[model samples]
Target: MSQKRVLITGAAGFLGSHLCDKFVSEGYFVIGMDNFITGDSKNIAHLTGNSNFRFIEHDVTNYINIEGDLDYILHFASPASPIDYLKIPIQTLKVGSLGTHNCLGLARSKGARMLIASTSEVYGDPLVHPQTEDYYGNVNTIGPRGVYDEAKRFQEAITMAYHRFHGLETRIVRIFNTYGPRMRLNDGRVIPAFMGQALRGEDLTVFGDGSQTRSFCYVSDQVDGIYKLLLSDYTNPINIGNPHEISIKDFAEEIIQLTGTDQKVIYQDLPIDDPMQRQPDITRAKDILGWEPKVGRAEGMKKTFEYFKSLTEEELYKSEHKDFTNYHK
Candidate 1:
């Protein structure tokens, strides 16, 4: 049989690039799409010469075009970080809405299975302790983070609609705090923010008195879970993330220890609508996909820090003192 083909939006992003690599390794013809709004070309540069890999420079918010037989489409295009979405709120909303619509249309035309990258943010400042797929989120629709939160909530909604109405094979993965290599150093996510500060010999910034919690899954495990979800017969949303939780204060200390930095952590008021407790109940993923994170925080952080340390002096120090006051990822 001929090799299968898959189109991955946000191809140069941290997670998307990794997904591209995964699909390519699985012997799929991969077509990666991105406009570089927040994605960096370097993330996907290694695949430049691969015969199975091709790239398209286009924004998914606009209409998408794919040639040849396409077996899968993973709609991951959007401003995933607080800084990116805050800077381009409209684009974030458009991609999650209009961009998703376009990808679904393309999937319909091509007779392909579709998967969307959803987020834990859908459960905005979640009232539930450990979020499950059935939990109706407690989101502030008009809040500052509403652009990304509502965008993802709508993404899931429309994806389900397409699955039901058009009979389009669809999967939704509600990703939690996933960290590994290729994460932009100053994206305002806690991992990169704290690590960047530690590398720069600066104090780690912990917003919200450091009590808010987060659970991080290593990138490779996240990719595996997504790969399994795409191939599984389940049609509803599934949470893919490490359930091991830690407070911001504790995570900051871990960074300091990992980097062997003398700088202390300073606390500030947490950003508005920031989830005080973020953890995923992955019972569905385990039951359906037999997926669980294999990388521990200690091992994953070491690998991640090694990658960050590989950066040049220019990347390490760029925006060294950028305000992390709003860092709540």
Candidate 2:
């Protein structure tokens, strides 16, 4: 059999870049497409010369026309960070709605199996802990964060429509908080936020009382689970994340220790609709995909710290002082 051809949208972003690398190493022809809206080209710069890897500057919200037989499509294009989505609300909605539509259509036309990257945010501010895939989320549609949350919800709905109505092979993996190398220092996710602050010897900002909890999954483990889901026949949404929970305050303290920063812990008002607690129940992922996160938080944090430490002072400063005012514009 010929080597499989895989198309990954948002191919320049954190998870997408890693996915491209994995496919290339596995001897698959990888087509990575991104608009550079939230993704940076530098993330995939190393792969520019690889034979099995190709990059396209395209936005998934627009129609896609590609040559050759596509064996699989991974629709992961969207502004995933809260700051990013809030900065470009319209773009967020479009990527989740129109972009997903285009990818599903392409999958149908090419007879390729597809997987949509959904999020644990689809659960909104969960009323349940250790959220199972079956739990209906408690989302606020009118809130500031609604654009991202609802867009993901709609993406899942339409993806399932294609699967049921069109009989297209489809998979959905609802990712929880994930962090590791390649995560933008200014992405505004908790891990990056804390790490950036500690690296700069600045006060660690903890939103709200810092009692809220979240589970963090290492990026490699997240990519591994995604690959498993894509190769499997599972049609339902599988929760992919580490179940080890930590309070926001403790997470901050851990970062301070790791960075050896004496920075103070500062409390800020929680952003609108921030999930108070998020921990995935990955029973389905384990039983079906036979996947579980292997990297412990301490080890993952050490690797991430090393990556951040390698940045130049200018790069480090930008990561630490990212402006959020124009995020939506």
Candidate 3:
């Protein structure tokens, strides 16, 4: 059988790079695209010499023209982290809106299936615990984090519109807080933030009294769920995350234990519109895709700690101080 050609946007990102590796290893011809706004080439550097992999530097918001009979398109391009989208708000909106639309068009033209990477941010600061896909989110459209939340909401809306109106084959995965190797150390997401600080022997910053809770999905499990969703016949959005929940304070303490650092947990004011709790109701995913996270938090954190430890002292220092420089100024 001929290998399917899979094009993944934001292919240099944490999740994107993992997807690229998964697809290529499964014998798919993988083409990765990224503008490096939040993604870096170094994330996908390991695949540079692979015969089954190719890389393209392009923004998904721009016209994405590709040749050949593309088998699948994984639209993972977006400024995902708070620091990233907050710094480039308009770009975040554009990638979610324009970028998704462009990918759908490409899918339609090539007669290929497409899976869009949506986020749990679409849930906003939820009024419900263990958020299910059926729950309508309580999103603040004009809040500081609205750019990312509403952008993803709009991405889902337009994607469904394409599926219904244009008969385009589409799949949407609502990704939860995922972490592992290749995560950008300065992305301002909680795991990397805690790990980077601990590596440098700095105080771990926990926002909002550290009471907020979240479920962290390991990257490999996330990639598996996404791949299954893309190949499945389901067209509606499905939540893909570990259902286990942990408080921010507990998470920080765990990292402290894992890294064996003397760093203490410090409380900072929570950012505006930060979700107090986020745990995905993955019943739909489990029933439909037969997938759930296999790695527990402790094991996942151990693997992640080893990855961070492999970085040079200078790299770890830069990651730790990068976010603080602007705050001090």
Candidate 4:
């Protein structure tokens, strides 16, 4: 039997890279696409010599040209982290809207099953607790963070259109807070910020009153959920994340204990439009995909810390303070 062919955009990113590894390990011909905008080459470097894995340096927002048939297309492009998106707002919006459109067009042309990566941010500062797919999100469209949140919302909208009108095999996974290896030390995400501080013997910074809550899903669990969803028959958006929720302050303390660092917690002004609470109601995922996170926070954090510990001292100290040109195409 011939191997299945999968095309994964943003294949050099944290989640995208992991998806590539998963598909390749499962005996699929995985084609990785990336522009290195916010992704690091080192993430997919391990598969450089693999026969089944191929790399393409291309931006999805631009015209996408891929030869041969694609059985599956996992549209994982776009700047995911807050810091990265804020720095490259235009590109972030373009990838989510234009890039998703291009991927959908490609999938339609190739008669492939397509999956798009949506986010918890779509539920922006959500009013509902343990957000369900039915809840209409509370979002400020003009807010700074709106660039990302709205982009993802648009991506989901167009994907549904394609599924309904073109009858394309499509799936959307609204990912919640996920963490594991390959997370950059200075990505400006709470986990990386706290972990970097702990690993460097610095005080961990907590934004806001620290009462804001988030549910974290380990990468392996997240990937498994996505895999199940891709093969499932669902067309509407589904939440795929760990239902385990924790506050920012409490999570920070957990990081301190996990890293064995004596650093005290420090407070910082909360960024505008930061979500107060984020927890996915995975009832749909459980019933539909039969998926739930298996990795506990303690175990996941330990593995993540070890990965960050292996990085060079320079990478450890490099500031991720976003310093990029504004709104460039």
| CA lDDT of every candidate | 0.93, 0.92, 0.89, 0.92
Task: Report the lDDT tens digits of candidate 3 across residue range 1-329.
Answer: 88889999999988999999999989999999998777778899989889999899998888999978899999999878888778777888988999998999999999999898899999999999989999889999999999999999999999999999999999999999999998878678999889888887789999989999999999989999998999899999999999999999998988898988888889989999999999999999999999989999889889999999999877776642223223111
RMSD of model 1 against the true structure: 3.4
Candidate 1, residues 1-329, lDDT tens digits: the string is: 98999999999999999999999999999999998888889999999999999999998887888878999999888888898888777888989999999999999999999999999999888888899999999999999899999999999999999999999999999999999999998887999999899998988999988999999999999999999999999999999999999999999998999998899888888899999999999999999999999999999999999999999999998763333233222
Cα RMSD for candidates in order: 3.4, 1.8, 3.1, 1.2
| Candidate 4 per-residue lDDT over residues 1-329, each given as its tens digit | 87899999999999999999999989999999998888889999999999999999998998888999899999999888888888888999999999999999999999999999999989999999989999879999999999999999999999999999999999999999899999887787888889889989999999998999989899999999999999999988999999989999999999998888899998989999999999999999989888999999889988988898898999899877655664477
Error of 4 at 113 (Å): 1.0
Error of 2 at 305 (Å): 0.4
Candidate 2 vs 4: which has more TM-score: 4
Q: What's the lDDT for residue 214 in model 4? A: 89
Give the CA lDDT, 0 to 100, for residue 169 in model 2. 95
Candidate 2 RMSD to the correct structure: 1.8
User: What's the best-to-worst order under lDDT?
Assistant: 1, 4, 2, 3
Q: Which stretches of candidate 1 lie over 4 Å from their true place?
A: 320-329
> Between prediction 3 and prediction 4, which has the larger lDDT?
4
TM-score ranking from best to worst?
4, 2, 1, 3
**Which residue pairs clash within candidate 2?**
87-327, 87-328
